[model samples]
Target chain A: MTDTTTLSVEELTQIVTRIFSQNGLSALQAEAVAAVIVAGERDACKSHGIYRIEGCLQTVRAGKVAPQAEPELIDDGSALLRVDAKGAFSPAAFAIGAPVLAQRAKDQGIAALAINSCTHFSALWPEVEALTGMGLAALAMCPSYSTVAPAGGTQPLLGTNPLAFGWPRPDHPPYVFDFATSVAARGEIELHRRAGKPIPEGWAIGPDGTPTTDPEDALAGAMLTFGGHKGSAISTMIELLAGAMIGDLTSPEALDYLGTTSLSPHHGELVIAFSPEKFAAGRGGDPFSRAELLFSAILGQGARLPSQRRFSARETSLRSGIRLSAAEMAMLNEFLAAA
Target chain B: MTDTTTLSVEELTQIVTRIFSQNGLSALQAEAVAAVIVAGERDACKSHGIYRIEGCLQTVRAGKVAPQAEPELIDDGSALLRVDAKGAFSPAAFAIGAPVLAQRAKDQGIAALAINSCTHFSALWPEVEALTGMGLAALAMCPSYSTVAPAGGTQPLLGTNPLAFGWPRPDHPPYVFDFATSVAARGEIELHRRAGKPIPEGWAIGPDGTPTTDPEDALAGAMLTFGGHKGSAISTMIELLAGAMIGDLTSPEALDYLGTTSLSPHHGELVIAFSPEKFAAGRGGDPFSRAELLFSAILGQGARLPSQRRFSARETSLRSGIRLSAAEMAMLNEFLAAA
Candidate 1:
């Protein structure tokens, strides 16, 4: 067993950056990837955090993902753009695309961009939060390979697709929310597998269409929709909007060729950024000020922004340092020792 | 007992319009409202269909909703607009706003609009469908009085906020989706109440914060989020984006007067329209042809659009006519008799 150690954000970032660089990623791409991974870990989202590092490295080493590839702009105009990711890491694509979309919105009041065939984006909130913090409201959606089942049926026809939205708030962190449209994420399944625990029924179904507690069975099975039919409907909508709208492969059939490796997993992303100033302009009051007044009033009975919980966790981590489970630490040490 | 009847969409629309006019709405406003209501009924969405007419009329009579008031443009530019609903019918607002946004998007590539202090707009898909039929992609979100609890909390803090999105497809109907973040709608409670049936536990809770099956108690209580914390997070995000971002009231605390009877319920809407031609310009393929090719490839394994079920219902209704339940027929007859 490996002893757990607490590392500052900078320390973790450096370690992650070194690991990615050693695993065949370019220095710039490694830095971007490291930032995302460390941010997830800092926010207590272990699923998308360092736990994903090994799999990403494996994909890079297998030549399934192109670490040196860069996204190319297919179109750019007043309020719309299309980008081809060219098999690069999604963080890099997003880093390149989000700013362009934000700038377009600033120039034209509204903007949208489509990113096609990118690798997995670790988490969505940071990108949206960054835009919202810059005083623009943003919405984003991404469709991934099929891992989640449709609402009622036992078939896996959709990914654990995630959607996020961010809005600026006065004197507070922007109200950022990010979530998957599945009952539980594949990462949770990994957690259960590590603990030798059976998952609750309804979270997943086996290949034979039976609900199973065994993580092994679930790995072969499908993740359930988040809230039955409504969640299923939303997931299906995401499949169309993020997948077909962005011109990437979607659903099980699309996954047949695209899902060969984690690195080559077919994916698409849609981003929308707009200025609230467009609506609140010349209304005789500061838009952000009025927004704060309105939000404060609505939250009158003690409510919180969507990102408050994650922000609270971040605060705790900042104050007391982050804590990782022994198993996670062991895995990290193993990775480092191998390196 | 009331006799059942099968009416054409035109017949239903006429009756609904007549009733709205009799209840003090202007002829044009009545027609617009009737179109939305009847279309929802024809598509089998009883929740936002005729079942809501009585409550809507009551709201109008109470002077909480205006019958003939016009929505004034608060701001207008090349690619953005804001409108004050001025207590008018939301459908009327949509009648004015949707087309304007779509037209601007066509001309400028994208457009956005904010509608503030409007009453509930029934059945968002139809409006999005209308936009998509015009070859524009549309997205809309609306916030209402808080009726949903936040994630990990039992207090009601959000309306059963609904979101809708649409995309223009080739040869087929526009892909449209509309859904609420709640596990069930407030109308579902009324349905169970009328039938004297108990809802499933966990669907709702009482004012005292205990889960209850009684519809009346659930109404007094709060509706549970569709997917627990995940759904709640999305709902909160919508509240912030649609309400706070648009400078409308969000939480209960912000209200000057609380309850269902308040004229200004802090409602807000955000609408976005995009033209694919803006991005796919000079791509050497017709827009519809490109969309069709991508859709066909993505849906190779019998995949379906999000609105396929509702569209099928509409087709079936067109063929055999809509079949209202005995109770629903009774309610319709009551309205007709009163008219």
Candidate 2:
């Protein structure tokens, strides 16, 4: 087996930032994008961390993604905000957009940030988690080219559209979850395929509309919508809410924009934030205290919150170091040499 | 087998409205609530139709629900509105809240209506469907007393929260979906139990947390979260969104308020409406035209939209009349006689 490399967050961020700078991003833009990936690394979410650096590098190299474009903001009203990402690196746009969303939600009761023309290339949790840190409830949904079929159908007509949510949890880390509407995210199937592992039965169907345990067939064909039709409906809603509502390409439209009929799904994202204190009736005390009642109930049942694992992993990695595969380390060295 | 009774929409509405009126609801309140049940009846959604009429009757009789109370609205700003349901039937509150939400969304870009003190006892689709009829998109979520077990735990701690969403579809009836975050609604299990049918595996666990196909055990024990952990996480988010964030009772609190544990869930709901015309860019035309791109894509794949079945069922029922069993007809007669 290849050796694993231990890298501190500071070390990885510097190297990744330098590589992004060499690949046409401004220093600030590079740092912003690198910070997102590094945070994912610190949480040990490989699909979003160093594992995705190559994808980001390729998109930047092809001139398909703008590295230094300034995102445009449309000030609609006190609670309404719109943004045009202008083909920029998605994280860079969000870096400019998230704080504005949180502040507006704070000043007003609720706020919506509609982001268009973004080439979203990171996990959705960071933006939402940022909002939660500011004591705001945050929601983010994004659409991509189709890779999931509506339940009861054989064709892939919906993106594995992801939805992320974040809420404050009193003294603990903010409660957060970022998940794809698909039964399983595509990266997972690829991981299973790479590991030569048989996939679970309910995870996906082959092109012939039959159950398949082969990860390769599952990925090449389509993943099942989570919980059948309900998940499919949720994905369709995301296609409308995050895609059409935000004035960006829907899943199919993303294919046309990307010049691909059936390959990768890439498109825009939408985020909304709500201020907790503004709308509370105090019927059940403060929001967090009321939340504690449910939290205690959940814990009493020996069930863990969805965000606990990621938050725990992040804490451990930050205290010690993030782990990277030997291949990932080599790839970083190659990028450093090229830079 | 007992004979089936076919009742016209008008006949059913009259019967249901009369029963509510005799049960202390005003003519307007009775009509509003009956209209929702009749719509469910027209869609052949028996679970939300006559089956739930008794729940409404009992809650009103128990004096926990105000059948004739007027819902109050607090206008927070251009985009935010808070509503007090006055402990009224959810449909009546929505009858008062939906139009105002739609109007505000039309005037502003987006709007939210936080409904508090509601005794929601019907399908959430009608409220969102009303928004869709006005050429808008809408979302609604409501919490109930705990019935679903969190993913890794034996004890039930979260409500089988139902989330409903709607999107306007040009000339056709709007696309709409209302789904519980649980594997199967408890009402379904009760129906299976009544019919002497076996509940599906993976549908629920006995109180012991081991899988059981006995519908009775499933109902008495706990419902499984749909798609395992992800669905549980969604239910948790709903608890925050519809429960704590709105300053209403969360699942446990709802149980405490109701003075029962593991009984029927009763709690509040939250609704949001979005005006489609407000945010569209001319990149691929208006939002509706852009949405047409997705609608065409879905239909082209020989797949149906999520709301197709309900919409089509409603049309068929409208033409052929709704079907009810002998028992159901007798129950309606008894209610009419009592009224």
In the range B242-337, model 1's lDDT, one tens digit per residue, is 765566666453333346523335366878877766644543445456456534533653445577777888888888787677787787767777
lDDT by residue (A15-102, candidate 2, tens digit) is: 8999888888877568878999998888878778876777887777767677787878777564657777788777777777788888
Best candidate (score: TM-score) = 2
Which candidate's lDDT is highest?
A: 2
Error of 2 at A193 (Å): 3.0
Cα lDDT of model 2 overall?
0.82
**Interface Cα RMSD for all candidates?**
3.8, 1.8
TM-score (all chains, Cα) for each model: 0.87, 0.94
Q: Which portions of model 2 show Cα errors greater than 4 Å?
A: A1-7, A260-266, A282-284, A323-327, B1-7, B260-266, B281-284, B323-330
Q: What TM-score does candidate 1 get on C-alpha atoms? A: 0.87
lDDT of 1 by residue, A1-339 (tens): 256677778888888888887776777678888988888888887777898898787767777677888778765355667677787787777777777777777776777877776777577888788798878988888877778777556667787878888877767877777888888888789889999999988899999867999999998888888887677767766665566545565555347755552543656677888777765554444557755664553366455556676777787777777677788777776766766
User: What's the CA error at residue A160 for candidate 1, in Å?
Assistant: 0.8
